[model samples]
Target chain A: MTESSKRSRQVTFVRFALAVALAGTAGIAWMSFDLGIWDQSGPGPGFLPFVEAIGLGLIVLAGLPAYRASSDLLLMPANVTSILGQAAVVAAFAILMPYFGFVAAAWGIVIATAWLNGERNWLAMLLLGGGCAFGIQYLFAMLGTTL
Target chain B: MSTTEALLHGLMLALQPENLMWGFIGCFLGNFVGVLPGLGSSGAIAILLPVTAILPPTPAIIMLTGIFYGSNYGGTITTVLLNIPGEAATAITALDGNPMAKAGRAGAALGIAAIGSFVGGSIATVLLAFGAPSLAKLGLMMGPAERCALMIFALCLLAMLLGRKAASGMAAALLGLLIASVGIDPVMGMPRFTFGQPELLDGINFVAAVMGLFGMSEVFVALEQRLVGKITENVGPIMPTREDLRVSVKPILRGTVIGSLIGMIPGTNSALASFLAYGVETSVAKDPSRFGKGAIEGVASPETANNAFANANFIPLLALGIPGTASLAILMGGMMMYGLAPGPFLFRDNPDIVWAVIASMFVGNLILLILNLPLASMWIQMLRVRYSLLAPVIVLFTLVGSYSISSSMVSVWTTLTFGIIGFGMKKFDLPIAPMVLTMVLGPLLEANLRRALTISRGDFSVFFNHPISAVILVAAALVLTFLVLRLIFARSRTPSFDSED
Candidate 1:
């Protein structure tokens, strides 16, 4: 997409994000108010959170209109696949960590992420990835802390 | 303990093999981090924060600081060679540093920067050694009201100085407060926004948030722009000529003084100090035009100033518990996570931690100078490593780091979530530091303010009633007014700062 159109898209995305943030903040403020904001002599549990929510809401509101017509978003063809691929690698690691343990889980993360990022030589990847995983495990062992 | 005595004790602690190892690691990683483009000291520290969690507070902090000053010292090499600033603080250095490379004095430029950084860092550390104890002692004298006011002053000042847009800074800071309100209230034990998640009962992990924001986002950006920074080939004669030293020494000293003072201020970022030093040096020179043409002073002044600014930034963090800049803010947060509070009570309550950290910086600076001197070629090779190759390593480290925190997936998931948010924030140019700073300081800020009010039976005027508190509040108000006026003027001149400014 064109730069200007790209910018407007970002602006729109930001506006939506801000609006959601506002709703969240306003909801919290209402809940805080219900929970009690003041006592007989001083501020209550909800007082700080209530004020904080209001402050956040106001700032979101202030910048709401400025984003109008800035640009429409278009996905850049480059690197989008790689970014998603990297995210998936992380997700996979998180999912596998409990079962595989630190050393095994690290091996999966290292090999997968390196492969995703275009390190195609399997032997070389194993040396780098396996060595890295073993290195990390060794470090943890030395520290007497389980990863 | 007296400053001298504490420092001596600290020196002993820092000299221990474990602490020395951390110092060496911090410096080594620091140089590599600085040599690479995009991620600065704050980002590096954030990613590495969890790695140091297993260590004691003193050594953990010692390593974090080594990463910080080491990055400042190492950032100069890329500027001198590639003309691309390795970090924001070195941008001004590139203006003169790159030209020196073109003139085939790349080694001299790099050499002078090393010497300047060493000199600047050493002097700043000396100042920190003296200033921290005295200020901490004064901090000991302050009441809740005064301390609250100081926090307010720092937040306002940082927002005004650090934010590209005044409104965005203030907004990010407010958002931080909201984030801080998430877990159980320290005063009442009632959850604010935990949403019944047992994991968040204690609150969002500061290190997790930082790692996601600074570390993971780097992966995203690196993916977008595949980085392969230029290598300075056959970097010749890594020594400054005697004549070059004569020309540079005075400016280096001047830059150190200028950067030292500016850095201690809450919001004068290191970049600004470097630029200011450059401006001052150029203006004072007989042939000002010689600048941007490989003038040794051009390389010397900014290099010195940036390191000076970096080392001096620790003063506020260690002395008063207020982090004016992002890097210091992260270190301060990491300290808190390590169970060391950084306020006035820090000196009295944890003299060992305070003293050891100071002594470690002196050692860190010495190591950085030595590392940068004869070992620069090795450092440069690190720059040649592609971002694609680096990405997997970071992902692995970050995953392990997040999991190591609580030995649970909760922190990892949280960090991953934040990484996406941080990447979005960067794309939108929303400043990350203010959010992180407010998160770190939020609970304490609220507690202090509440305590002061309680002391006065809920009187709003208690803040104003205290003389010191009154002055600080007035200063915060003045800064707020200045921000408003700046916003008005800037809007009048341009449609959007992102576009026009």
Candidate 2:
């Protein structure tokens, strides 16, 4: 695809994201108002949120037209893989920590992350991951703090 | 107690073995992250913020502050050896530091930088010791109206002065305010945007947001930029001559003054301070052209300036409850986590903790200088650590940090969700610092404004009636006008002007 076309796609994606965010903010504002938003002395619960949501929504709308230009914002293929890989690892680590415990989950994350990013030797990965993970666990443990 | 007496008391507390150990660990890690790319003091602090969730506030604050200044000091290693700056503060050092290294005076260049940082740090800390108390005394006189105005002024000035585009910065600030309003409203005991989730009633965890924004987002950017740096094996002459000291002395003093003053302001940071110091050094030099060609002053001036700026940033944070820079904003978050707010009252309410933190810094700077000189050769090995290997480890730590906050999965989910949002914001060229700072300050702004209104019996004119509040609001209005004009000018110049960062 042309670079300009790639940029247009990214911009459209961004605009769509902004729209969703605006809608979320607006929905929240609506709900806050529904909760009964008036008091004698000053603004109530919904008052500030409503004003803030409108400001953000307007600003997001104002930022929309700027995406209409040719630009170089598309991520390269390798970077996309690397970013997505790391992100997925983070999400998985967050999920696995409850079941596996912090230290074990950490070790797993380290190994998985290292291997994903090209630490080929499984033994080395285990050593490095185990060493770092357990080291922190021990350090915090000694300090009487838990992960 | 007098400043001198309080500092003496603080010294006794900081000397405890456990506190000393934390400081040493922070310094060592500071050097490690400083030599490596991607993570700076702010990132390290965020990733480690949860660790502080369990410790006493004093030691935690000391350790984190040590890590912060130490990282800035550590950043000098790569700049002199390999021309890679760890963060903005050290970028100025690279201009002449790399040339000096190539000229085979790498040790001398590195040595003077250490000296400059130490000198700058000590000077700034001394100023902080004397400065904070006086500033706090003034703050003690302010009513709620004035405090509210001051905070708004701080945020407005920060948004206006710090960014390339004022409108985007303001938008980011507004977004932060909106995000901060997600939980229960403190005044009315009403939930605004919690979506019926009990987890959010307390609000978005600061550590989670910090992890996602500064920590995870950094990983994404580093990956995109393909930043894998190599350490130079041979760093020449690790010590400076008496002649080199003579060359650097004046520049260090000049930088210290410039950096300290800039740091006192609400928005300027060490990066700008270093650049300004370098510019001043070059312009005032007897031989202007000697710069960018291994001039020792080039390294000394900016290095000194940045360390001074880093130390001085705490002045605003401590005295006025305003964070002057991004890292300090995170530090303010750390302060909040400790159940300590950074207002004038903090000085009176938490004198021991505050003074001990200040005293620990003096010790931390000494320890950094004392250790870093011999450890320069050792720190270069840190360069061999690749960003790829580091990225996953950071994610693991970030997960632990997010979970450690509330011991809940919701915090983890919040982090990952914002991690994705932060990634997108970064890729799209938006500045996250403004957003993060505003989020932290936004609730305070709303709370204070409401409190004042409640006092005034619903008079909207109450804000404009008070002199201090009126001036601050007027200043905000002027800043807004500037943003409007800037938008108009840019729009006239280009078809799509207002949309960018």
Candidate 3:
């Protein structure tokens, strides 16, 4: 594999590993806080969740050996930057959703995302992004499904 | 009771002006996406799924189904003319097709493919019309234990077929199962993996996951390549010679049969079917050396198999209400959203709708045959457009498509996250299809397994107690064993399959 490819894989493995670890820890911690005893039915509310978290953790742990043997990190810096940038775009829209309502939020998301994708032409972005938002809003409103 | 009566009733529903128009529109849109690589039936269906939420169930499903198979037919165009496959299923077409194109026989290759697809699709649709109810009845006889075993068999088969490394496939499948275990436990109605996030209480949306894994990942890869240039090449005439037709007939027939059978198997995808058909035709050829060098049979078999499998893949969904692939999974969601169940009873309860849908396939195939010939030249023109223009549009749609699924920005983020992961996996030569298949099947396998165990008083051996379940389990075990043995043997020798991706 190319160096960049190898780095990309490592980054992914590390991110997944961290997510798994955090999930497992949270699950275990949550179980102790509430629901003093595990419920009798098949599995309690926390039982499967904790089990899943631990399972994910173990899988991630197992991957470390493979990662070490492979001679490459799982992710590249550019990849990380892109992933983080994409996440920030979504987060911005999400934080604005309640204040802006669905139309504003949707339009904002479409335009922001399109620009992030490298379409900097203001008119083109608005035409494509704003038009899509309007079209979707119209369709959803007609269907009576809450946006 | 009569065929004429059935046909008339189906035509009545299918030929309604609105329905007919939607069918044409669906076919047209489907062909457009299919001509583009990195887009497939599921993405097309997902993008339009919101539209279906507004329309009547029957017409909505009919249009969506038209798009599904229509895209399959359209995919072969790129594979034959350019060396690029529009979908993985069309990859085999490129083997001989590119050679033929270079030989200035592009017209013949495309013509043979179109004819072969029509013949294959028509046969499979006929089989589906007559045999669906019977197969569904057979499926109904299977209990939860059998279903679980069947799912296991499917996972095993898919791993063997698609995975570069069996261990990694198993790990990926296990991770899918882990992911599926999120949300509230189905039996207890208690949240499991929400981590106190209200949004996660409903669990990760399948649509988001799919969009991320397949669609977003594709965009990331495109970006990484910094691809901004147009790719256009001169394509020759649009008609096949009489000799070309004669040479292609047998392979088309062979591929059609092979693809239909493979498509019936739950986890065997069209790509594998096409590959297998190509391998078979080449091996059995009188002159094997001619196989990759513009052999007409090579083009004929994969194209025929690809379309045949696309049609036959509907069998599992219709019979057991279980989706055998990603696209079918979306169809299942569509059916449920329409408040129409897809199991054995659907056939008896909704014959007119069912038969009309089947009948529409016949019409759709004919439409595609006519449309593809004239449109081939135009589609080739699309390839001339630069990636810089296409990339932004694809990115815009990907974001919009992911967001539209739940109106949740989290889903959009998930798409980008998974896209990067997908790009990484691609770089490492990991097979993404297995991950996709597992992601789709994970929850079904878990739900059925849990249901079977609960029904049998937690007796784990219920899986083995049933005859069908036992047989499927044994088959899965045997396949696993064979794969392990093959790996060991290969490692000890030349390590022929070491190159991943």
If you score just chain A, what TM-score does every candidate get?
0.79, 0.80, 0.62
- In candidate 2, stretches whose alpha carbon ends up further than 4 angstroms from where it belongs are A35-38, A70-78, A145-147, B102-105, B482-501
Off by over 4 Å in 1: A1-11, A69-78, A115-118, B82-86, B491-501
**Winner on lDDT (1 vs 3):** 1
User: Cα lDDT for residue B410, model 2?
Assistant: 84
Per-residue lDDT tens digits for candidate 1, residues B1-501, read 677888999999998999999989998887777666666777778777777787888888899888888767766776777766745678778887887887778889999999999899889988989987788888888898999899999888776665346677677778788788788887778877778888888999888888888888777777766655666665678888999999998999999998899878765577677878998999999999898888989989988988888888778778888886778888888888878888888888888888888899889988998899888878777767655566677888777777788888888888888888777776666777778888889999888877887778788899998898999899999998877777777755532211100
Which of 1 and 2 is ahead in DockQ?
Answer: 2
| Candidate with maximal lDDT | 1
Individual DockQ of the candidates? 0.53, 0.57, 0.25
What's the lDDT for all of these models? 0.79, 0.78, 0.68
Instruction: Please give the lDDT score for candidate 1.
Output: 0.79
For residue B162, what is the lDDT in candidate 3?
A: 49
Q: Which rank order by TM-score, best down to worst? A: 1, 2, 3
Interface RMSD of each: 2.7, 2.5, 4.3
Per-residue lDDT of model 2, residues B1-501, tens digit only: 889999899888888898888877777766666665656666767777776666788888888888788777777887777776656667778889888887777788888888898998888998998999999998887777777888877776665564455656667777778788888897888876777888888888877888787777777777667765545555776778889988888999999999888888765567778888999999999999999999999999999988898888888889888887767778899889889999798999999889989998889999989777887777766666765577667777787778778878888888888887777776666666777787888788788878888898777788888887898789878876775676566654422111110
- Scored against the native two-chain complex, candidate 2 gets a DockQ of 0.57
Please tell me what DockQ candidate 1 reaches: 0.53
Q: Which residue pairs overlap in candidate 3's backbone?
A: A7-A73, A7-A74, A7-A75, A8-A74, A8-A75, A9-A74, A10-A73, A10-A74, A11-A74, A11-A75
TM-score of chain B of 2: 0.93
